[model samples]
Target: MTAPQSPIGAHVPVAGGLATGGLKYAAEIGAEAIQVFVANPRGWALPEGKPAEDAKLLARTDVPVYVHAPYLVNFGSPSEETLAKSIATVRHSLVRGRAIGARGVVVHTGSAVSQSYDAAMAQIHDHVLPLLEEIPDDGPDLLLEPMAGQGKMLCAKVQDLGPFFERLEHHPKLGVCFDTCHAFAAGHDLAAPGGVKDAMDALVATVGEGRLKLVHANDSKDVCGSAKDRHENIGAGRIGEQPFADLFRHPAVAGVPFIIETPGRAPEPHAKDITTLKSLRAD
Candidate 1:
C-alpha cells in the first residue's frame, strides 16, 4: 500500500456510546488518522459485543483508524492465567480491529511482573511464539509499544527490542509503535540537540524502517530516564517542540501515523495539536 504524505492524528475518545462518534469527531477535526481503545483501556474484559453499524461508520470515515489494546494485558507476565488472558486479548483485539478496518492493533511491550530477567525472557518465548503463529495473515499487524523504563518492564528502550525480535525470529508481521514521551523517559534524550535524530537512527538500526509502524506523540512530564509514563501536551512539557519537529521531518517515520496521546486543554485541543503536527511535516 502507498504511504501517506502526512501522518498526524489524535487519540479520539471511545468512552461513551458507539465508536462511530469518535471517528466522526476525528474526521471533523481534519485528522488523517486516529487511535482509540476498543474497550475500557485499563480492563481485560473481551469486547462485550460487536456493533456492525459502528464498524460500518469506521469503514466509511476518511481517516485511518487504529486500536489501542487494553493496558491490563501483560504478555510477559509470569502468571500462566495472566499470560493466557493476554494472548486471548491480543487475538480478540485483532478480530475487533479487522472488523473495524483498523490498520494496526497496538499493545504495550508489557512487564515481566517481578520475575528474573532470564525467566521473563524464557516465558515470553515459550508462550508468545505459538500464539503468534495462530494469527492470520489478513489480521492487522501487531504493533508492540515500548513503555517507559518503569518497574519490571521489558523492551524499555529501542535497543531493548532486539532480543524480543530475535526470540520471535523476526516475524515479518511484527512491527513497533514508538511513543515519544516513553522514549524520552527511557533516556533517549529527544529534548537535547540532535537527540531526536540520534534516537531515530538507533531505532532504525535496531528494528529497521519497515517495522516502524506508528508513533505516539506526546510531550513528557518527567525527565529523561525517569521511568515514569506521564504525558503532557505537545510543547507544554520537558520534551518541548523542537524534537517533535525534527521527528516529524524524519524520513524514517514519514508515513507512519503519529497519534497524539496528550491531554487536551479544551474541546478543540485535539484539532489544534493535529494542525501543529501537520504543519511540522517535511514538505
Candidate 2:
C-alpha cells in the first residue's frame, strides 16, 4: 500500500491491534497520519502496553499516529469522583500515546454540567495545568478539542477558549485539535462562502497558529449553531464539498493533518473522502 501524499487520514479502528489492525487499515485507505483509541472509548480503562507491537508499528512508517482520549473524560465535571477520574484518564492517555510515539492525544473540551462556566474553568485549570507541567519535552502534546455547543459547554465557541489558555499560562504542551463539525455547531458557519477562512482567521487570532496542531475534518449532520455533534460523510451533510476545498487552500492548515471522523462501516467511503479532499488541495 502507498502512503498518502498529504498529511490526511481517518480515525481508523483498533479492534485488533495498532501494528496489525489500525496501521494496516490506515495504509489501505492511503492515510499518511492516523488517529486511534488506545483503550475502550466509552470507559476509563487504562490502556495496556505491548511494547513489541508498539515498536513494530512505530518502525513500519514515518506516518504520524494520534490517540483520542475516552469520551468519559470530563475534567470540568463538578462531581469530585468524576473529576478525579477524568484527570487520571487524561494522564493515562498521555502515557499510552507517548509509548506508541503518538504526535498528540486529543480530548474533548467537556461540559460545565450545572456549574457556572467560571467555576468549571477554575476546576479544569486546577486539574489540567499540573498535568501539562509534568509532560516531558519528548512526550506527545495534549490537544484540547472543543465540543459541540451544548448546554454550559466549556470552550464551545472559539472565544471561550481564551480563558482556558490563560489559565494554563499558554503552556507549549497544551495544543488544539480543531473539529470542523463542532466549530459549526458552535456557530462558526464554516460552510458558508468564505466561512472556512474566516474561522481559521479567528483560530489564529485566538490561539495563535503554533498551538493549532490537528484537525478533526468532518461534515455536520446538523445545521450551524444547532449545538449537535452528529457527523456525516464528506459532501453528504449540511456542510457540503465547497468548504473543504477552502479548507485545503487555507494557509493555517498547511502541514497539519486532517483526520476524518465521519461515519462509515468500511474503508471504501474513507478512501473516497480522502481522495476527494486530496484532489481539492491547492499545493
Candidate 3:
C-alpha cells in the first residue's frame, strides 16, 4: 500500500484496555500516522506482548507509527539510579521501536532536579551522550521533546537546546520534536502575526531543517509564556487557529507528521481538529 498523504495523527489511547485496540481505532479515524506508548505511561515496567505479530499488524497498516517513552524517564537526572533506569528505558524503547517498525521514539528533555544548572548540564553531557551513542543506526532515532519552561527543566526554550546538540556533537540521528503548546508556553509567540513563521525560522536556524522530525500539534490552555503545560483542543486555546494553519502550511513541515495531543472525550471530537489540520495542507 502507498504511504498516506502526510504524517498527521493524534495521540490516541494506548494504555489500560485500549492498547492494540487504539491503534486500529486511529487508523480507522483517517490517521496518516499515529503515536502510542508501548507500556504504562507512568510506571517503569516494560511492555509484555508478542512483538513479531504486533509488528506485522502495525507494518501492514497504511500509517507510520511512533512510540512515546514513559513520563517518568529523566535522562538528565543527577541521581545515578534514575539516570541508569532512564538509559535502559530509552534503549528498550529504541529496540521496540525497530521491532514495531516505528519511525521514531519520543522522549522528553527532562529536568535537572534540584541540582545547579551547570552541574545538571554537565551530568547530561557526561551521562546522556554515552547512552545515545549506544543506539545503533538501524534503530529509530530518539526525538528530544522540549517541555514547558518549568522548574529545573533542561530545555526550556528552543535556543536552550543548543547545548544538547553541542553535547551530542551534532549527531546526525539526533532530531527534535517541536511541540506547539510547549513552544508557546516557553515564550514563543506562535499565536501572534508572524509568530509561527518566526518560531519556525528560529528552529531552522538553531537545529537546521534536517533534524526537524516530528511536530506535536497541541493548543495551550494558558496564555503564551505562562509556563503551563495544559493542552486544549485545536483552535480552542491560546494558540488559536491561524498559527496552526501557518504551522501546517510551512514548507519545513511539508512531509512531517503532526501528531495531535489535544484533549478529546470521543473520537468524533477529534474530527474537527483533524479536518482543520488536513485543510491546511497544500493541494
Candidate 4:
C-alpha cells in the first residue's frame, strides 16, 4: 500500500479536552495532524490526563497527535530543584502521551543559565538518562527541539546535538523536531543557494534520518543569526515562501509531518498557512 501523504497541521489549543478542544481545532483548520500541550505550558502544575476524552480523539485514526512539553521545562537548569522538576515534568508528559497514544512529545533543548556548556551537558546527562531508561514500552518518542541559538542553550544548532545523541547511545526512543524559524534564527539560511539542502544534510548527519520525527513549520520575524525566537506567518515573514518549497522537497523530511506554530491560534489563518504549505509540497 502507498504511504499516506505527509501531514501538514498546526499547534492547536487544548482548552476543554484533547478530544473536544484540540480535535475540533484540528478539524476546523483542515489539519491532518496536530500538536497540543498536555498540561499548563507556563506553569509547573501537572493536571490529570483525561484518557476517556483522549480515547475519543484517538478513535479518529486519520489525525496523528503530538504533545508539546511545557515551555518552563529546562533540563539543564542551574538550580537542582528546577532540574528535578524538569525531569518529573518530562516523565509525566510521557505518561500522558502514552495515555493519549501520541506519536511524540516535543521538549526544548533548554539553557544552562550561568553554567558552562560542559556543566549543562552534565546536568542533562544526569537527568535525562533515567528518562531514557524508564520510558514505558508504549511511551511516545521523546523529541528534542533545538532553540534559536539563544544564550547557553544546549543544541543551539543542529550540529550541537551530536554529543547528545552519542550520550544517549542513539536510543531508538529519542527523536527530533526541527523548527524552520529556529533554524534561520540560528544562522542556517534557507534563502541562500544550496542552504536548505545543506542544512538538512547536516541534520541527517548529526541525528540520523529515523530520529527526525516532526517539523515545527514556522517563519521567522527576525533575520538570520539574530538568535531571536519570534515566529511569523507562512508567506509574510523574512524566510518568505519559496524556501519552504526546498524544505518540502528535502529527502531528510520526506514523510515528516509539518505542524505550524505561527502567531495566530484562530483556525482561518492556520488553514491558509496549511494550504500554502500543501501547495509548496507539490511545487
- Write one digit per residue (lDDT tens) for candidate 1, span 199-272: 88998899876898999999999999998999998788999877888987777876788899878664477777
Question: Residue-wise lDDT of candidate 2 within 1-283, one digit each (tens)?
Answer: 4222348898988776877778888889888789988878998778675745775768868989899999999988899999998988888888888888888999999888988888888887888999998889999999999988888778877767788799888999999999999999999999888899998888888888778789888999999999999998888989988888788777777778889988887789999888877777643
TM-score, predicted candidate 2 vs. hidden true structure: 0.95
Off by over 4 Å in 3: 1-5, 15-20
Query: 2 or 4: which has the higher lDDT?
Result: 4
Worst 10 residues of 4 by lDDT: 1-10
Task: Give residue 148's lDDT in candidate 3 (0 to 100).
Answer: 94
lDDT of the candidates, in the order given: 0.81, 0.86, 0.80, 0.87
Candidate 3 TM-score versus the reference: 0.93
Candidates' RMSD to native: 2.2, 2.9, 2.8, 1.5
- TM for candidate 4 is 0.96
Best candidate, TM-score-wise? 4
Report residue 239 deviation for candidate 4 (angstroms). Answer: 0.8
Q: By TM-score, is 3 or 4 better?
A: 4
